[model samples]
Each structure stands twice: as C-alpha cells, then as structure tokens.
Target: MLLLNNHTMKSKIEKSTFIVKLTAVLVVLMISIISCNKELTDRKDFSNNTGGNVIDAQQQKVLYVIVDGARGESVFKSSTPNLSKMIKNGMFTINAVSDENGLSATSWADMLTGVDKTKHKVISEDFSNNKLTDYPMFFKRVKDNTSLRTAAFSISPALSTKLVTHADVNTSLPNDEAVKTATLAELANNNAAVVLAEFQGVDKAGAQYGYDASVPQYAAAITNIDTYIGELNTAIKARPNFSKENWLIVIASNKGGDYPVIPALMDQTLYSKPLLNGFVILYNPNFKSTIYNKPANLNSLPYLGSYGKLNGDTIASVDAAKSNLYNFGTTGEYTVEFKLKVQSFGTLNAPIFFKTSSPANAATGWWIIHNGSNGTWRLGGLASAAISTPTTKAMEVNQWYNIGFKIYFVGTVRYVQLYQDGDPIGSPTVITGRTVNNSEPLVAGYRSGFGNSATQFITDIRIFNAAVPDAVIKDFACQVLLDSRHPNYNNLIGYWPALDGAGTLIKDQSKSKNDFVFQKSTQWLSFEDYDNKFCIKPTPELYKIVPRGIDIPRFILGWLNINATGFNLDGKVWTPIYTNILK
Candidate 1:
C-alpha cells in the first residue's frame, strides 16, 4: 500500500498535479456556461460564488453538534433517552479529549480545521489571535469545492463570529433554545447540506456550580441538553428528503471541568496528562457501535534505558565540579541532547532543563523553557538572549521528542540553536548573554528553587564539546549514542546512556565516569515508550479521503508530495474537480 518509496511517490504527485490543472479548465468552461442565460428562477438559490466549484453527492453530509464543558461521565451516564439510543447505535468514544488541552478556542479550532494549535495558531479565545485564513474550517472547505454544498452555523453570539465565512446562513442567538430554533428552520426550510450547532449551557453550569456528577446544576444542564438533542434529531428525521440523503450526526465536547490536570505534582501522583475527558458520538444508519483497540502509537521511541524521573526539584545529582555543564569554560560551542517524554507540565514557565544558578539570574545562562503565553518552546532565555525568530509549538505530553540545543560561538557572538529530531526549529539563534559558569550540577528534569514541580523521563543525555553532526543526530536520535570507545567520543564532555534499569548510579559512558547516584530511594522503573501512536500507518491508502465534491479518488497527500496547485488553497483536497454544477 503506500507509495512511500521515492520513485512511485514522485510520479504519482506529478500525475495528480496534471489532473488537477486539467480539471480546473473543465470547471472554468462549465462556470462560463452557467453564468450566461441562467434562467432567473424565483427560487432563492442560496448558492454563492463560495459554494463548491465541483459539486457532487458523497455518502453522507455532516451535522456537527458541540456541547461545551460536557464531561464524558456526565454525558454517558445521564438519563437521556435520545443520546443514549444514538450512543448505542453509533460509533463513539467516551474517553476522547479535546485535541489540545481543554482550551475552548484551541479545541474548537483544531476540531474544525482537522489540525492542531501549532498549525492553526489559535492559542486562546480572541479571534484576532487566530490564523484561520491559512488554516480554514471544513465548511469553507466544502464551499470552495462546489455550489451543491449549503452550510448553516447556529452558534453562541458571545463566542464565535469568524467560524463562518462561506456559509449561506449564519445565526447567533441567546440560548440553546434559540440556537435550536434557528437550526430547525435551516433543516426544515433550507436544503443546507452541512450544519454546526453549538450550545454552551453545560460549560456555564460547570463554571457556576461544580464539574462533578453530584453537582445538581451540572447534572441539570446535561438533562436539559438531552431533551434538546432529541428535538434536533427529530427535526433532521423530519426532513422532506431524509430517506434519500445520508446524514452523519457528530456529538462531541471541547473539554471537561476547570480542574487543572496537575494541581500540585509530587511523585508519579504529580504526573498527569493533558486529557480533556470528553465523549465523541458519531451516528449514522449504516454504522454499529464498536470500539477498536490498538497500541498507543503517539509517536514513540524504542526504549533503550530507564528514564530520569524527577519529582519536585530532585535531580540525579552529580557533584558540582563533576558536571560537564559546570566545567565548560567561556567557549559556548557544544551540543546538549536528550530524549524527552513529558509526563506532566507542573507549572507554566517551569524549566525542563537549565544550567543557570537561578531563573532571575539567567542573564548569563540559557534555558529551554515552556512559554505558556503562546504554548510554544522558548529556546533562548531571560530577555534578548532568546531566539528572536519566533519559537516552535510546545511539547505535547506522552510523546517522545529528541530535543536539544547547539550552543556555538561566532566571533565571540554566542548563538544557541534549538533542534527537535535533528532539524532546526527556527534558525541558529543567538544568545547574547554568556554563561555565568556556576556549579548548578547541570540540572535536568526540574530545576532547583522552583515552587512548581514537573514530571519527565529523559535518557541518552550527551553534552558534546563539539556539536553532533546533523546526519548523526537525524539517524540516531533514539538509538544508543556515541560511547567512549568510538572515534568521536573524545568530543563528549558528559554522556549518560541511562542503560540497565537496575543501578545505584547512571554512568557517564563517555570516559568522564561522572555518574549520578539515586537520592530519592525508590523503585527504578524500566524504560517503556508509552507514546500515543495515532495515524502511524505507512500505507498510502489509509490516508485517502476525498473532499465532499472532488470526483477524483482520495489519494495520499503527504507521501505523494502533492502541492496546493493540485488542491484548494489549504491543500486539503484536489480542487477544480470535475463537476457539472460549477457552471
């Protein structure tokens, strides 16, 4: 299945590219014909230029229903006849979480765009903070393809205005009833093919009362919404052509309650994932409620050794003088690398790894910090010393990333470049501040004197006096690193392979023998790559998905390297697809 091998992939992309250009020509001719001498019928053609240029019917149209702050437990166990029936008859997941942490804006944007906050650039609720033009919603996607698509958005007035750009009908109302009423009108009167109806009552309940099942207001909110869900389903079934049309009803929540994922982390108890704990229900006539169990392929690594466990500020402490970080002189040319798996982000701005004596005194030191304001990695440190060319997105929990930095000097101008999986994030960045040369023990995991605690698993740490070559880094990111016997091992100042789970100390394999012994006095857990593996298949067929109207079969996008010239502006699907209605 996959055309992943270089030869077949290249040729397929070329073929698809040509087909898209040819179809664009066909679409244009059809459009010209439709424009001239179109019978000016009295029927309100809700059709706009934004409607899909290549209109055709797919197996099903979508009705996206979102209930804010509805927890999985509340929704699944609530006494709701209609939702219960739908769940029993539908393909659903009760353990689903918002794609990003439970932030409403980021969650909805990601769901709508089928991408993450990194791609969509929506970190918060403010519409101005979004970059939706580059990453658009699915409705806009359908509309761009053909006019056979008609969409309606019945949403909360206070929250979203930018979600709809090409929809034929957009309504904003005060309450769920008003939103339901508008949605009903669209379903009954208008031939809208796709719809999004969002209600915020459950979230309001959680914000007002508590998020637990025992909370009366929260329970009441769920009960009331269940009634409204029944009404909406009834309206859809009552459609004139309901028998002919295939409809897919999707019910999901953006997030759960306001409780922080990790209130005050300590031990493994302090560790918690970014789980939103919401439900997803997909209902259609031809579907049965079933669950698929598979390995967690959240982009993991082959576990080679026991990871460094840090609870509170407790580190695998080496004597101050023995630290490679401490012994390095004024020369800033070196590479520090580790395979990192974030189990918990204790508090915002807590350091993952830093060599500085104090965070405030970080004017002379460098850090790889979590910048919460933007939910991204801050490569430089303090103020002007950090990378100026915009940082990359923050690390997601429960995934493995080979993260590190190359601190090198150019004519005494210190530049520290950040790398993930061997590629540069921005550019070779400059850190104007020089190292303070402190005996901070080259702190890994959590730094000292930080109130907020964090949980992480790190291994295969290497502080090379010379930067590791890009090829070596890329090929062996998760593999066993260079040892003392290797030719290039002399460049290494400190190397902790973290091999062998049972040990009194983590040995520095690269000649120095500066090992750190256990101080926490507990079980040394073996390394296991507990990463979440989603969409890990190499088969190209698995990635195929036709945009609603595109006549061409869904083809692999990533491996084939098909450009947007063969697709819509966002490269979602091949555009100018063959269809008669475009004209």
Candidate 2:
C-alpha cells in the first residue's frame, strides 16, 4: 500500500509541473503575439504613406507648412494619421523650440530671414521696427541666385503684406482653408521652386480653449489641419510630373500657447516654459528617419526634498558628540556653504544659516542674512548684523543659487567674505571683536518673521573645519554631489546631502556623522534634473544651434544649394541627412 501511494504522488507532482510549464508558455506566446501585432500595425501605417520610393533623377521641390501656436508635445500626442506618416518617413523633432522673443512676428522674421530677433528686430505683432530689408526674405535670396519662381500664401494678411517680399506670388487669405486652397492651386499649376503656406486656425483655437491634447477643440483643430495636410499631399502626388519630382515637405509650428501652470512642467530649465515649445518635421521620401529629443541638461542638480518654508521651519543638527566641530571661533577659520532657493524675499532679514540659538545684535555668533530691501546678502558678525559689504547682485526669488561664506584671517586681521556660486559676492570685511563659537547646534533656517508665506528650500549643507581656498570653493560650489575630489574632504565636519527621499532624519555622509533632524514631518519634493544655467530662457546664441524657427530659412537655402556665406544669418542649418544635397 505505501509503494502504491508513493507512485501515485510522483505522478500527481509531474502532472502539476507540466500544467505550470504549459501556462508559462501560453503567457509568453500571448505577449509575443501582442508585440508582433503592434509592430505590424506600425509597418502597415508606414507602408500606406511611403509616397513611393525615392528616385535619384527626381527634381527637388519644397513645400513648407507652418501651424501657428501648436505646442510640439501636444501635436505629438494628438491622433494625426497624416503627421504620423510623415514623422515615420523623415527627420523630425517634437522638442523643437520657437524664437526666444516669443512673438509671432519675431518667429516669422526668423523663419523668413534666416536670423534671430536680435538682428531682424521684428519683436511685435505690428512689425514696427524690423531690419528685414538688410536680411531680406529667403525668397529674395532664392530669386537672386536662380530664376526659379517662389510663392507664399498666408492666413495672416500681415505676413503677406509685411514679410513675404521677393515672392513670385504672395497671396494673403482670411482663413486656413483659403490659404490651403491657394497653396494647392499654386502647386498644381505653377512650377514654383519653394511654396510656403501659413495656417492660423490652430493658434486661434489654442488661444480660446487651451494648448494641450486633453483640450478637445485644440486636438480637433490639429486634426482638421492634418486632413488639410493629407489633401495637400494628395495634390502633390496628383501632379502630372510627380513621378519625377522629389518633394521636401517641411511642417512646423511657430510657437506653443501659454496655459495655466502645470506642476509636471515646472522643471527648472527654459524647455519647461510652454510658450517656447514647438515642432519641426523635415520630410522627404529619400530621407532616413531621425528624431531629435530634448538636449541633455549638463549643469543641473537633482531636486530631492522640501523641508518647508524658511519662515519658522528649521532643520537642526542632532546633539552628537562631535556637534561642536562646526562652531568656528573668531580665531578659527572655517567655511559654511549650502544650496538655497528663496521663494519670496520678505521685509525682514532672512537668516539662512547660523550657529547660535538666539542670533541678535552683539551676539556671540556669526550668520549670513539677506537684506530684502536692497536685494543683497551680507556676512554678519557678533558686534554688528553685517560684516562684509552687501553683494552687488541681489538674490532673485524662485531661482536656485549656491551661496556661502568663508572666514579667514589676513595676518591677524580676521575677514569674512560672502560667496555666490563659485565667485565672491562682495568685498571681504574685517571682523572686529566677534566670536562665532557657540554651544547650540548648527541651524539651517530660523524664524525671523520673514513674512507670511515667505519660504525657502535648503539642502547640500557642508561645514568645513578649515577655510577652503577660493579656487577650491569656486570649483565645488555648484557641484551637486560631494566626492573625495574636494581638497577639504578630510576637513568636513558636517555634510548633509538632504536627499534621503523619505524620513525626518537627514543622514550626514561625512565622517563626523552629525545628522540633521527635522522638527516636523518631512515635506519632500522632486524634480527632473534641468539645466539651471539656462534656468528661465536660453540665450539667442544657444538657441541658434538647436532646431528652432530661425533655422527654417537656412535649411531651405541649404536644400536649394544656395551659399548663404555672406548672409550673416544667425541661424545654422540642421543637416541631419542629405549632407551631399547641400552646397
């Protein structure tokens, strides 16, 4: 009976194992089928819009479409079969930016003249003080080189009247439909070398509703324009000589629309600004697919946590055996540095970091305070509230800054100097009769009646036992992570990265092990590592290299094999593919 039972159990176990293996195989097969279906769907879509394979002997023609106020990300997210087809077949970038000036005329001038707003000066909608005559429209450049006819049809009358110079046929229409009709007719009958059609309905829809894909009207408007684009493609294909023509179809948006503040888009970089976002698609059947993404932000710090507003919120050091190592006496030289972001500057002096529990006039502690009235910070000693001169550059609100102070002596003359980023904020001041040594734990923030709702963020607090050299201070002030490369790495008495994603205690990575204990619950915040160097907006020079509205003219000129050498255009050509096509 026992032998029979054992044989039966082994058989049951084998059957169970076989069932489990079968289930696993079925799940993998289902996943593989789903993935293959998606790939096949994509391939089918691409095949339907191939526009025929490229022919080496085909004539090169240009068709550029401009959709006003269409945010790049929104357009990418929208369901547009026509745009998607082109995107899969050619070079594209949803991360393209508009003009830094953020005006329609500024963008138009950049697109037509191959230069930035600083050169063309078309800063407003009215086109009051523009230097377009010096850097005339690309149509004029094309006309000067070759006798090829160029035409432009714009929904905005101002574009035709003020900006569309040197065109063989410049027609100003009232609506997108009319502009599309005119452009289609021009493409059908005329042998135009370059054709430009500007549609304004997208911008109008965005202005009324919103600029996001979630907004029905905005998405519908983009889709409607996508249908018009499909019709235009059909017209181009219907041309009698279409089989012998190589069309470079370019589609882009002038700028993105402004909307309510979105927390997700609040990355501390120019790319975070909605008004600066746009799209660019340079399509040709012969071109290989090349999609550009947002450039990697080289100089950015990861935002980890938010303890609270600086009004009364404080993160103090725990009472450890080596807590007194941070106390810098009048005779002892030391450096205290941290990253700060002030939300608002109130009337009262903001005490960023101090060693004393009660920091007052003639107190035996040193402190760094920001004067709200003059927009400058000063190093304070015990005898007086301020020791060093006020910084020339006032600290701006809602911006990340690396600020600290160094206390050193010049042959018995103890001096305190305030530093911003890696450079000195103001001239050093002589410290006369002040002792910064105290028994109280080193405090990061304190209650100064800074005003209701006046808050600040503090992190990456580093306190050194010795005064670091100026070069060393400058080198590591903007550094996000603490490493052994620092010359004063061994002199670090207290170092709190404050990046512990959770918990009330901020662990100190230094050898002293003096941790910071938050008084209240940890209020943590997160951020994408954005380039703080170009926090708000990139300079026009930086925008020149990226895919922007300004590059459209230069790109067109390159496609036409025209040498824009002496044009002195600020915009550079984005030659991703077809390098041999450009002169």
Candidate 3:
C-alpha cells in the first residue's frame, strides 16, 4: 500500500487503533486543522507593490473553492454539471497532488503553503507542528503585496480560525448553504480581491456512508455541493461590476475518499487518496482551456521551454549591430546564455559565439568555440585554445542543454568560466588574450569554427553586459519568465527568443538594437510544438464510482444550462456524445 504525504510512519503499529476511536480522532484532527495553528511570531504585513493613490488597474479577484474528499474520478464521471462547465471554459488538471500523508490536515497544509507536508510540517492536526514561518501560505503572499482585500469563508469553523491566516475578512459558518450565502453577500457588499471558500459536507457524508459515489449518501452530498457551486457562480456573475472584475474561480479537492477500490488487496485507505491526484481547475473567461501534459519521452528535468523555437540553419546569423550591446569594454565582465541542441559538428565547427577585431584575421575575437581536438568546449583561439580540463560527462549531442559562458578580465589575462546545463564545467579556462576593442559585430550562428556544428535549436539566448552570478544563471536555466520580467532584465543587453516559430526578424525582447536577419528562409524553420519539452502537469488520478443514470433535471433552457454559451470544456462548440441532441 502507498503512503500519503511521504510522511515517515512512527514505526508501524502491530495494529491500527483506527477501528476503535477513528471518529473521535478524525473529528479532533479536523477541528485542529481549522483552529489550532498559532500565529507566526514574525508575521508582517505584505510589502506593497504599488501606491493606493494610483488609479487601480482593472481588479483581479479569485473565488477559491476547496471541495473536501471529492475524488478526481467523481468530478467528470459523476454529475457535476457546474464544475464540468467551469472545466470546459478554463484550465484544469485532475492530476493535482495531495500530500502523501492522506489526512485532511496534510492536504490542507499543502493547499495553503504550496509545499509538501514535510516542509509545511503539518503531518497530522497538531497546529504547533506547523512551520508557516518558513513556508508561508499563498494568501499571505497576496495580502502582503497588493492593496486588494482578501477573505476566507468556510463551513468548518476551525478552517477560518486555525488554518487560514492574514485575510481582510474571515467568516466561519454552519453549512454549505450558509457559506455560499455569505460569499455571495460579500461579493455584493464589496468586491473582495480574493475569497477562499471551503465545503465540508462531502467529506462528512463520505465518513457517514462510504466515499464512493455508488454510495447513495456520498453521491447525494456531491450533488448538493454542485448546487451550491452553481449558486456561488451565479452570485459571482451577478455582481454589479462583474464585467470589470477579472475573476479566477478555482476548484480543488483535498484528499480523496475510500470508495471504488482499485484492487481488493491494495489497502484502499492508504492507497485511495494518494492514487487520486485530485481535481483542480482555474476558471477565467480569458483562460484558454489548454491542459499541459508531460512529453512521452520526458527526462527528469522539466522546463517551460523558450518563448518559441529558434531554428538554427547553418546560413543565418543574429548580428548585434555595433550598438555596443555585446562590447564588454575594459573590465571585460559579461555573460551569455543559450538553450541549444547541436545536430552535428560538421567538417568545420569553429565558433558558436564571436566578437572579434575582424572575421578573417585571428588577431582578437572572444569565442566559445565547439569541437576542440578533444571535442571538449573551450575558449577558441587559433592554436593555444584553453579546452575544458576534462569531464567524464562531456557535452552530449542531440540533447538540449542550458549553456552559460561568463567572460571576465584581470590584468592582461582573460578568464572564461563555462557552465554546461548550469553546472561549472571542469575548471575556469585561463587565456592570455583579452580583446578590449568594441569594433567587431557580435555575430551568432555563422562563426569561423573548424566544422559545421549546426545548432538544431537555439532558444532563450541572453547576453548581459555584466558577469551574472552562477546562481542566477542556474536559476534562469529552468525559468521562462522572459527578458523584461526576468530578475536580471535591466542588465540583460540582448535577448533573442527564437521560438516564435514564424518570424523572419528575430525580435530582441530586451528592446536593444540587436536583432537578427533571416537568410535562406527554407534552411531553418521555427517550431512551436511544446511536446518536445517536458511538461509540468499534475499526476492523473483516474479511479471513481459513477451512480446509475438518474435522469436528474438538466436545466436545459435556464441560466443553469451550461450549453447556453455553447462552450465545451476545451472551449469548442458544445456537442452531446449521443446522437440525440435533445438529451
């Protein structure tokens, strides 16, 4: 049986005490999660991102819904018309992970902190075990930075008191209907920037009967919650200034239930919640219902990939015109980055990067040339090139790598630091020549290298005037926040995203004069497919119990009818699976 939340067991008991006092312990834990965690001693108001005096931008708001014990399978399989509509019009992933600890407390901790139970330290219901100081909740992150108001509403009293922290308004009520009413009332009163709402009846019913939807009480609970969800949606849309407010409605489940056993021998309790990756959806009118999925042949490392693909044909070049963009004057401290995959080092693969006195003469040019005598990356020169000391793991071909080069000068000697996929390669190369001249054009792709080491794709190419630290370079390798949004953007001289898939002029996102010209269009082509890069998506949980066809009222013509907008979950035209259109 799988363990939930990856928490360490306190030495397996000869037998569990669950059968004796399960109800009492569960009730206690639930109450503790809601009311027990103490206030962090070092709590501070979130730092302001902007002044209150400035005309506020079109406000963004969130209606965060936590549906307890609503297994991933029940969402689409059972009748959740409202949720189904939201999934169709927004971004959703049924693969959101719950902490391996399987308890409501563990799941709640992760939901708040965006961390595993180990980091949040909420393995059980003991609030004293919470380490919110280090791993603060997302609500705190929101409240601290923006002028936007935030609130938390929950049917469980302890949730608003114990689990939730730092909100402008918080209300704990008795039931789902009450919570929904309060949320709606608040929306009408003042447009709260954020509202985190929780419904507990589903879990309460699951505990009373069985969590599987086949169990009448559990399915009934789910149906009732769907009704409340519809009401909440109506309230959100019915607000006076709804059009001006961009609302993000998110629905997520905590732990799963113990119904619909996958296999008889699998110890359903331990495996149930862990197997369910859980359901989560971010619904917004502007959201394109695209679901990101991992590639079939994905490696362990995940990347958001470049802004677009940079097709590297041997003939093209991105010449940084003499705008002094690439010139690392006298101090000679600069960093250049590229996520690249070399197809083949043909007969003459000499230079991958160059800024020289001239192209033909070898007098002075800074080069990170590929294909040295040892096939090791090196600082290129005519003869005395300093190759990487030696690496058992040299640059492999055909695989993508985030390569960074830091060049600096001390006295007359030039120092070159090589970072292959964010790690320092071998040792820093010490070269004697320092090309202090800012005369030559900064040329990429068509270098005077020995062989034709054509780049298959060059994405996220960034050049900085100052030497960037190894830590920042490592961090940037995995992040795709892009040029201006990047923490190091101000110093970033040139950033050419070759991933637009359909561009002749490679736009320099850094807004510098350095842009590239496409020569022989047929030789290279930008590819927009993300299937090549590893996807960052939740794990899919696909087990559920669907009740028999009850033929419940579908609300075909009224506001309850999801098809009134004719939008499918993928935002395609709504079409019933069966031939009968008048279902």
Q: How many residue pairs clash per model?
A: 19, 0, 25
Weakest ten-residue segment in model 1 by summed lDDT? 548-557
Evaluated with lDDT, which candidate comes out highest? Answer: 2
TM-score of 3: 0.47
lDDT of 3 at 247: 68
Descending-TM-score candidate ranking? 2, 3, 1
Best by TM-score: 2
Candidate 3 residue-wise lDDT at 277: 42
My TM-score estimates for the predictions, one after another, are 0.46, 0.55, 0.47
Report per-prediction Cα RMSD to one decimal: 21.9, 15.8, 22.4
Query: Poorest 10 consecutive residues of model 2 by lDDT?
Result: 44-53
How close to the true structure is residue 528 of candidate 3, measured as C-alpha lDDT?
34
Runs of candidate 3 exceeding 4 Å displacement:
1-174, 177-313, 318-320, 357-361, 372-375, 381-393, 409-414, 430-433, 436-438, 447-455, 479-487, 522-575
On lDDT, the stronger of 2 and 3 is 2
Alpha carbon lDDT at 169, candidate 3: 85
Instruction: Choose 1 or 2, whichever is better by TM-score.
Output: 2
Q: Which ranges in model 1 have alpha carbons more than 4 Å from their true place?
A: 1-59, 99-101, 260-275, 292-459, 462-583
Query: What tens digits encode model 3's per-residue C-alpha lDDT throughout 1-583?
Result: 3464233353333135554478788888987775433222112111222332111344556777888888665655677888877766665655454556567776776666555555667776656667767765556656555566778888766567667887878889998888888887777766466777889888888888877767778888888888888888888888888766656677778767765555543332222343344676656654445453323332222443333222344433555454466655545578888876655544444455566543333545555655542345555442245444355646656566667678766666667777876777766766444444555666556543344445555666788877777877776675443645456688777887665445566667785756765555424343333323332232222111111000000111111111222211111121111111110
In model 2, where do residues sit more than 4 Å from their true spots?
A: 1-56, 296-430, 433-546, 578-583
